[model samples]
Target: MLYKRGKTWWVDFVDASGQRVRRSAGTTDKAAAQELHDQLKAEAWRQSRLKESPARTWDEAALRWLDEKAYKASLKDDMQQLEWLHSFLSGMKLPDQDCRASPCL
Candidate 1:
């Protein structure tokens, strides 16, 4: 299902794990949001069936990586590298940022 909040479109749907997932479609247009929702549903189904990872933004993945390393002994070294990477990578969407490679294809 699609809804709007402050010019942004959001979707709420049951995932393959029977978990309710709500995510922003990243657009204000209803048609585009619906299309994104449809794609998200399909991706969820595919990930559930094939045990693949879903789509992710670079920031999302990077933050996750940082979180995982929060307790590491070499966290400082990791942070230095992560900072450099963050600076190098612009905000553009990465086509292969997800854990699964080319799952959309």
Candidate 2:
């Protein structure tokens, strides 16, 4: 379902895991909002029924790494390195290519 919160449209629905998911559609247009809502619902269904996982980005992996390694002695250094790397790899999807082979590096 889609509803407006202020001027932006938001989506609310139940996933295949029976969990309620709600998030902004990130659009002011109702048509765009509905499209995003449908996509989200379809992705959730695929994840549950076909055991498929959504594509993850480098930023997501970096954040998860930071969370898991919060206690590491080199965490500060790691964060600085990640910050620097973010400029070149901010939105690159995970497992797509070798970071070392990236032309940006």
Q: All models: lDDT?
A: 0.83, 0.92
Q: Residue 67 in candidate 1 has what lDDT?
A: 89
* Per-residue lDDT over 62-103 for candidate 1, one digit per residue giving the tens place of the 0 to 100 score: 888888879999999988887888886746456754446555
Estimate TM-scores for all models.
0.60, 0.72
Cα lDDT tens digits, model 2, 58-82, are 9999999999999999999999999
List of clashing residue pairs for candidate 2: none
Model 2 misses residue 83 by how many Å? 0.5
lDDT, candidate 1, at 57: 65
Q: Which regions of candidate 2 deviate over 4 angstroms? A: 67-75, 96-105
